[model samples]
Target: MRSDRRTQLLRRGRNVECASLVYNIIEVAVSLTAGFATGSSALISWGVDSIVEGNSAAFMVWRLHGEAAGISEREVLKRKKTALGVLSAAFSIAVVFILYEAISKFISGETASLSWWGIGILLVSLVVNPLLAWGKYRYGKLTDSPTLKYDAIDTIICEYQTIVVLVGIAFVQWKGWWWADPVAALLIVPYVAWEAFHAGRDAYQVDLDASVSG
Candidate 1:
C-alpha cells in the first residue's frame, strides 16, 4: 500500500511538471513574439523568465522520476539545489534586463506601445497562470513536494506580474500616462529580488544539509 501511494504521488507530480513544461513553452514563444511586436521590454523579460521557470519544472520532473526509480532522496535533494541555483541566476538576469529597460524607457520618456495581440496574450496568461499554479499547489501538497510548491508560488508571482503589466498598458492607453508602464514594471522588481534571495537561501540551506549529512 505504501508503495502504491508513492507511485501515485510520483505519477501526479510528473503530470504536473509535464503540463507546466508545455504551458511554459507556449508562454515563452507567444510572450516573446508579442513583446517584440509591441516593443514592450517588460513582456520580453517576462517571457525570458518563463524559460527559466520551465527549466526548473524540467528538473522537478527529473527529480521526481528519479525518486520513483529508487534514487536516494539525498541525491535528489542535491540536484534540486543545483536547479535552484540555476533558477536564482536566471532571476538575477531577468531583474537586470527589466531594470535596464525600465530605466531606459524612463530616461528617454518613451512609452511602451501595446497591441491587440499583446493584450490578448496577457489575458490568456492571466487565466492560465492561476489555474496552473492551483494545480501545482494541490499536487505539491498531496505529494509533499516543496519544489512543486515553490514552482506554484513562482507561477502565482507570474500571474500577479501579468496583472501589473496589463494594468500598466491599460492605464497608458486610457490615461496617456507614459510613465505608468515603467512605474508598473519597476514595482515588480522588489518581488523578483525577493524570490531570487529566497531561491539562493533555499539552495544554501540544502547545501548545508547535504554537507552535514555527508
Candidate 2:
C-alpha cells in the first residue's frame, strides 16, 4: 500500500475505535437492565461478556494510537490469547455461579418474570454486533490489521452467543422452561474455556521485546 493509503486506513481504524466504544457502552447498559428484569443468568452473563468486550475495545484503541505504530503478527496473537484466557476463566466462574443458582431455582421451582426487556436488548445486540463487525472487518481489510480482524471475529462470536441465548430466552417464554435460560448460559462454558486456553497458549509463546516497557 502507498503511504497515503496507509495513513487513510489508519484514520479509518481510529474512527472505528470510537464506534466500537459506543457499541460497547450501549450493550453493557442494555444487557444489565435486561438481565435484572428477567432474572435470567444468561442475560446477565451476556452483560458480563459485554463489559469485557468493552475493555478489549478500549485496550485496542490505546494500542492503535498514531504513535503506537504496528506490531508483529506474533505479538497480536499473543495478546489475543491472553484476552481469551483471562475472559474464559472469568466467564467460567460466573457460569458456575449461575449453574448453582439454576439448581436452587429448580429445586425451589421458582418462576421468572417474562421480560421483553431481555429480548429487546438481544435484538439490539443482533443489530449492533453485526454492524460493528462489518465496520471492524472493513477497516481490518483496508489496514491489514490483525487486531481489527480479530475484533470482527469476536463480534461475530458474541452475536452467535446472543442468538443461542435468545433461543433459550424465547423457549422460556414460549414453553415456561426457566431451566432452559440458565442452561443456555452455561452452554457458553465450553466455548469460553476453549478460547481461553488458546489465548493463554498464544500469550505464553511470545517473546516480548526485552528493551520495551510493558
lDDT of 2: 0.69
Candidate 1 TM-score versus the reference: 0.90
TM-score of every model versus the real structure? 0.90, 0.79
lDDT scores for all predictions?
0.79, 0.69
Local lDDT at 124 for model 1:
89
| lDDT tens digits, residue span 1-214, model 2 | 2366666776677678678887778877887787777677777777777776776677566555532355654454445555545655654555566566556666776556666777887888888888888988888887777767877787899898899889988888889887887777777666655555654564565455432122
Point out where model 2 deviates above 4 Å.
Answer: 1-4, 66-109, 210-214
Best by TM-score: 1
How displaced is residue 163 in candidate 2, in Å? 0.9
lDDT digits (tens) for residues 4-70 of candidate 1 = 7877777787788888888889878888898777667667766777887788788778877776666
